[model samples]
Target: MSTDRKPDIALHFAPRTRSFVALWLLEELGVPYTLESFDLRGGRPTTPEFRALNPLGKVPLVVDHGRPISETGAIALYLGDLYGAPEAVPAADDPDRPAYLRWMFFVGNVMEPSFCQKMFGWEVAPSTAGWGSYARMFEVLTSAVDGDGWLLGERFTLADVILGNYVRFGLQFGMLDADPRLERYAARVTARPSFARAMAIEERESARFPPAAA
Candidate 1:
């Protein structure tokens, strides 16, 4: 067995949140790390202890080398770049870098908010909204994949790591209907040994802190 201790990647995870993305990235990197699960029900993340890590009181926060990194895209990109896993993340010099960054941020900034808006019946004007509308966002997402196994052609980069979580969540919550392409892609990605292990961890965490309150 490897005697080296896992890198100090402190993940403050909560059930049914974007923490899954960080967990999946850790698994994909095949690195050992510590997981500090926080319950959102009691406002645990907002407590002084957790607030010191992230004032926003959000899950999916990571403290690497004592540097707190919140936001899923930031954490994924940081890990992928630091670990030199170009296959999991494109290099900055790659021609696809622009596209990769664009989509990665889009998932967090655009798609996620749109999903929440649609799910919660929030009021908004399509003209003023960056996401335009839920249908529009979904259409764009579908077109981006277009039956591809991954977001960037044959390469399964960090883009997949970002979008894969949403695809699964959307399908599970009935926010997204069955698209053969998305179905195939999600299946293919989740079937990876790394993803399987991540899902196991997430499942256990979910059991420990159910998402009913969140």
Candidate 2:
């Protein structure tokens, strides 16, 4: 059932990006892999070799068995399907499957654009915008994680890994300011052992590539 038949699993990654989600996922998978870590600002991903893998030259490019996957949501789903246990990825019969897929896409489709709109002061009607406005996105997210420990209740699946980083970044960048429930939820997700492992790697890579000057 695994896509990558070969043993080679390398993450084409850079720190301080969505690569954090991919890092968290690899740790959760508990699989042996290599990190092709680099600095985005240093033009590592833009090289001809790396650009062949992902034309956009983006980080979080996961190469499994020499096959490349670029998007963060897609990477989460890929690793979850291939290596994740039942707890990480519910079976087809599981009722949480639908919600799991929904929230995963919600992070990229809804949260990404909505956050951009809010940050850049973009003006668009709720009915016209696909995300219905950043305010609505927050409302739906807050409602989902308000009382529940995870998105699918007790089960902490790949959806958490997909959405948790965005929620954490939102708080850190003041995008989701003054939201107590979301703050607590982000804390809980980052407190996981897998997250700790990812953070350790992140720290090492970040030190390797200090951020570019503004």
Candidate 3:
């Protein structure tokens, strides 16, 4: 079931942000969509109109035929299934679908909070927190991706998009410096041509919205 009637997809985006992951996924899909790029410093996300669609006031919000879908994972799953089905998204009965969904959720459910925990020096019991401890999160991720293929093996699905971006950002933020498995995994993820194209766009946009002078 498709959400957008006209396929007039719009990505509310920002340069050098988590929006990059969304942008990357879009490029991988090779779909024609409009980019509503803006500088967050200008408060585009805070406006009432934007908030009406995305109360979280976050970038990487995708609007499909005027219907807004926020959150990277949700957006990724939605767009992938809607547009890239049977390729980026497995069929409902596909064996890979199970693994795909699990890895898709892992980034948000485990990785994100765990990274924040480590970054902010928050101490939470592994059993208490949703993501467990950062160390435990890394251990599990290492076990998952410490291999010669993508998360779903031969076929690269949207799980790669969701989790791969996590790995890339993890390395960028020095969060995954302790492990080489994720490093190798990210190497393959970045090696994709879409990653290159997305980085190119990211460069072009970042230049337009250059960082403010320190």
Taken over the whole model, the C-alpha lDDT of each candidate is 0.80, 0.87, 0.87
For each candidate, C-alpha RMSD in Å? 3.8, 1.8, 1.7
Highest-TM-score candidate: 3
Better candidate by lDDT, 1 or 3? 3
TM-score of 1: 0.89
The TM-score-based order of candidates, best leading, equals 3, 2, 1
Candidate 1 lDDT over residue span 179-200, tens digit each: 8777777787777788888889
Quickly count the clashes in candidate 2.
0
Write the residue-wise lDDT of candidate 3 on 46-94 in tens digits.
8999999999999889998789999999998888877885766887787
* Model 3 ranges with Cα > 4 A deviation: 1-6
Question: How well is each residue in 1-214 modelled by candidate 2, as lDDT tens digits?
Answer: 2345344689988888888889988998888899988878778776999899999988889998879989999988877878787787976678888899999999989999988998899999999999999999999999998975899998888899779989999889977755989988999998889999999999999999988769
Per-model tally of clashing residue pairs? 0, 0, 0
Task: Give the residue spans of candidate 1 off by over 4 A.
Answer: 1-6, 210-214
Which candidate would rank higher by TM-score, 1 or 3? 3
